[model samples]
Target: MISVLFAVLTAISNGSASVLQRRAASTVPDAEAMHLSLIRHLLRKKVWLAGIGLVVVAAVCQAVALATGPIAVVQPIFVIELPATLLIASCAFRVRLSRSAWRGVASVTCGLALGMAAAAPGGGSESVPGYRWIPALIVTGVFEAALIIWSRRLRGNARAALLGLAAACGYALTAALMKDAVSRLDNGGGVLALVSAWQLYGMAVAGVGALFLLQNALQAGSLVASQPMLTLGDALISITYGVTLFGESLRSGWWLLPELIGVALIAAGCVELARSPLMTGAKPPPPRVR
Candidate 1:
């Protein structure tokens, strides 16, 4: 129960941090956008500093949650972060959430609950063998490298979306590795053991890569495109890793019907939220009557 609560806290902190960082990142100079020097400037901004603080808080919460809960249970809960970001942005930016936006929030909420419940994901043990890690890590690297190369040739929202997706993959892998490492720590591996573990090193690199991609995504275009891709992409990929790496499972044999339905609702909701005025900072589309 505490793990669930910690996961919720992680979601809240993560959602709020995204909004804050986006708001702060917008003020950054265009020339410095993709450069390493940008982080220096961002660190000087109070808002960015605050956002980083929240991110630290979020990471702590997530680590605790992963230690105690199934990766399947902990990670999908992050999908709600999209709607949470919208809500936080609406209040902080003083933007209005239109009727459609509220509807979208409700859709995401119900969908998340239904999907997670219907999925009924089961857990795995701490001892993931070395053989499983080889293919998984290789595939992850190749896919991310491909995404980076492809996105580099594009511009605007498309590039942002692709980069966000890549970042999502990185985060998913980081979460999985974190779970494994934490499990190791729980099962008698001390801090010294963790320092020597390859998963710990892998998680660090992946975490940095994810943050790098996220910053670039924010700079490239609107959160409208990037947010959903980041949210849904991470959730889905995390679910896959849970089953593959961590030996987690989901409900099947006809129970998949509701799972599919829930996925549909989540897609619809994220799309609606993306197109909303609150997220895009544009006027709401005109209501057409038959």
Candidate 2:
């Protein structure tokens, strides 16, 4: 129950964070790149700062949740952010919600709910030792860097999608490492004393890098394109890590059928949502009066 509560809080935080970042990114004109590089310079405004703050808070919540909950239980719950962001967009940003957008949100919500219910509770034990996480973090960082460079060669929507996917992978691996670190801290005494010095630094670096790339991806393309891509991809990667590395389990044979259906619904909804005109054609309204 505590795990479920943490998951829901994390999802809401993440969902709002994405919406805020997207709202900030939308303020920059797409034509600014073609018109003048200096015009693009104005993109470095306070909006991004606010968005970054929200994201940082979300990451902190997520780290705490991972520390306390089983991976399988927590990972699927994060998917709720997709629908939650839509709600934020409607209420906070005054973005018009189209029929297709609402449908997509519903599909994703239902799917994620089903997935979460299908997942079983676990002991949240340390599967991988604290020291082992250092090497894993380094390897994941290198891979994420390679993916970012590779994404640069692609163009338009393809590039944005690839970058979002890469960011998701980076985030998933970071979550896994954080979980290991948190478990290690539970061991007490000198172990926590020794690990605290460098582990926190490493986590901060990884978390910031992932957030930056995710923001870049959102800035580069439509929120519809980037959000669902990142959300769904991140969910899949997290689930993979949960099952393979953390030893999370499905409830029973009956659960597998719904789990498959849920994933399918999520994927289909994300695809539809990503291609929606509301997202692809979204533009900032005129600046409000003070």
| Global Cα RMSD, each model | 3.4, 5.4
Query: Best-fitting candidate, measured by TM-score?
Result: 1
TM-score of each: 0.89, 0.78
Could you tell me the C-alpha RMSD of candidate 1 in Å? Answer: 3.4
Clashing residue pairs in candidate 1 (N, C-alpha, C atoms within 3 angstroms):
none
Q: What tens-digit string does per-residue lDDT give for candidate 2 at 1-290?
A: 66667777788777666765665655655444223442344347665566567676777777678877877667777877766655665676666676777888889878877776665546545556556566666776676778788877765666667778877887787777677666666667446553764555666666666766676676677765677678877887777777766667666687888877888888767766665543444563454568
Most accurate candidate by lDDT: 1
lDDT of 2: 0.68
Q: What is candidate 1's local distance difference test score?
A: 0.83
Task: For candidate 1, write residues 1-290 as lDDT tens digits.
Answer: 87788988888888777766776666667677568877887778897788788888988999999889888889889878768878887787666677888898999999999999899987677557878999999999999999989988887889889988998999999999998887778878689878888988889999988988888887777777788888888888999998988888899989899988888888788878877665554554555557
Poorly placed runs, candidate 2 (over 4 Å): 26-43, 92-96, 119-124, 130-146, 190-197, 251-256, 272-290
Whole-model Cα lDDT per candidate? Answer: 0.83, 0.68
